[model samples]
Target: MNETKLRDEIVGLAKSMFDRGLTFGSSGNISVRLDDGWLMTPTGSTMGTLDPARLSKLDINGRLISGDKPTKEAFLHTTMYERRPKANAVVHLHSTHSVALGCLHDVDPANVLPPLTAYFVMRIGTLPLIPYFAPGDLKLAEAVGEMASRHHAVLLANHGPVVAGKTLQDAVYATEELEETAKLFLALQNLRTRPLTSEQVADLHRRFPQNI
Candidate 1:
């Protein structure tokens, strides 16, 4: 898609997430790669009210080329773009359920979300839990960069989730799946649960190599 159309679509989808309570306030951001660089949501901008024309535009070198200033976590998006050649879009959301799960003590760093459904397995593979860094901290970007090669999605402990996909819509869908899986995992903690078996997980991985 062209830059303008991509920006419009991103803003529309982000607002839908906000309207559905996946994220609230100014607590989420989205970005899409462009020929010149990227189109990103601006800092402190609520997703529910994003304006496509005002979306931040950056050059290939990460320099601001036009529009408003990009979110402070733009480095996180840049890190993924640099590491994953197929990642054309990134979405980070301070989603309530996922962030709440991140705060739990026993959440595994290697597999932050459980394999409750095939869609989750096909969309979000193994979600690593990176230790919390202050929002917008360079260290957070560095931490994600360190894991970018192996994981397309990660849960920032005490924060939320970050997802990278081949397109903006794909990124958004994966993020929503992440949040849903996190919500299910948390809800099932108090019950006697039966997760997918090792062989089942292996089968799913084989079917969706990009996700796993």
Candidate 2:
């Protein structure tokens, strides 16, 4: 999509998530790769009330090109872009369930989401947990960069989730899936849940190498 249209679509989708309580206040950010740079939501801008024309535009080198200032977490997006050439979009959200799960010390760092459903396996693969850095700290970006080449999505411990995809819509969908899976995992705690077996998971990985 062209830059203007892409910006509008991102804002709309972000607000939809906000309205549904996926995120609240100014707690989430979204960005799409542009030919020249990137189109991103601004700092302190609530996802539920984003104005497309006011979206921040940054040059390829991370300089401000237009609109309002980019989010403090802008480096998180750029770092992933720099490390993962195929990631054309990034979505970071403080979705309740996912963040809550991240706070748990027992959550597996290698696989933050449980294999509760096939869609989770197909969309998110295995979500690694990156050690928490204070919000907006460049260290967080560095941590994400370290794992960018291997994982498409990660749970930022005690923070939230970050997901990269080939497009803006795909990133958004994957993040939503992550939250849903996290919610299910939390709900099924100590309930004798039936997670996918190792053989099934291995078969899935074999079939969808990209997801693995």
Candidate 3:
């Protein structure tokens, strides 16, 4: 997509997510990779009202080349790009259910959510938990970089989720699927449930491989 159209798509999709209560109060960030660099939602900007023209443009090294400053969590986006060569977009969101899932103590860090649905398995696959670091900590970026190569989606301990995709739409859709599955995981707690078995999940992986 051209820069102008890509910018508009980011703004439109972000607004749709914001309007649906997927994110609020400037709590989410989105970035799309460009041939030369990347376009990122600005620091402290609300997803509901992002101005495409004012989005941050950064070089491959992540130095701001134009527009306003990038999100303080910009490292989250850059680290994914550095680690995953095929990823063309990254999304970080503080969505409610996913963050709630992160705070729970019993969930496995290696793969937090169960294979609750086929779509979840196809889009997110296994999600690792990155050790929590306070905002703007370089160590946080390090932790994310450690897992980015193998997993396209990760849950930040006590934070939220960071996802990468071949396209911006893919990233956003995967994030949404994650939040919904987290909600299902929470809702089914302490109840008799039959999540997809290992064999079933394996079949899905074979048939619908994720390529982020």
**All candidates: CA RMSD in angstroms?**
1.3, 1.4, 0.6
lDDT of 2 at 19: 94
* Candidate 3: Cα lDDT at 48: 96
Ranking by lDDT: 3, 2, 1
Local distance difference test, each candidate: 0.88, 0.89, 0.95
For candidate 1, what is the lDDT?
0.88
lDDT by residue (tens digit), candidate 2, 1-212: 78779988988999999999999988989999998899999999999889999999999999998999999999999988888788889999999999999999887788877788887887888889999889878888889988888898888999999899988888989999999999898898889888898888888888876631
Q: Which residue segments of model 3 deviate by more than 4 Å?
A: none
Which tens-of-lDDT digit does each residue in 90-207 have in candidate 3? 9999999999999999988999998999999999999999988998899999999999999999999989999999999999999999999999999999999998999999999999
* Native RMSD of candidate 1 (Å): 1.3
| Over 4 Å off, model 1 | none
Model 2: residue 18 alpha-carbon error in angstroms: 0.8
Write the number of the candidate with greater lDDT, choosing between 2 and 3: 3
Q: Report the number of backbone clashes for model 1.
A: 0
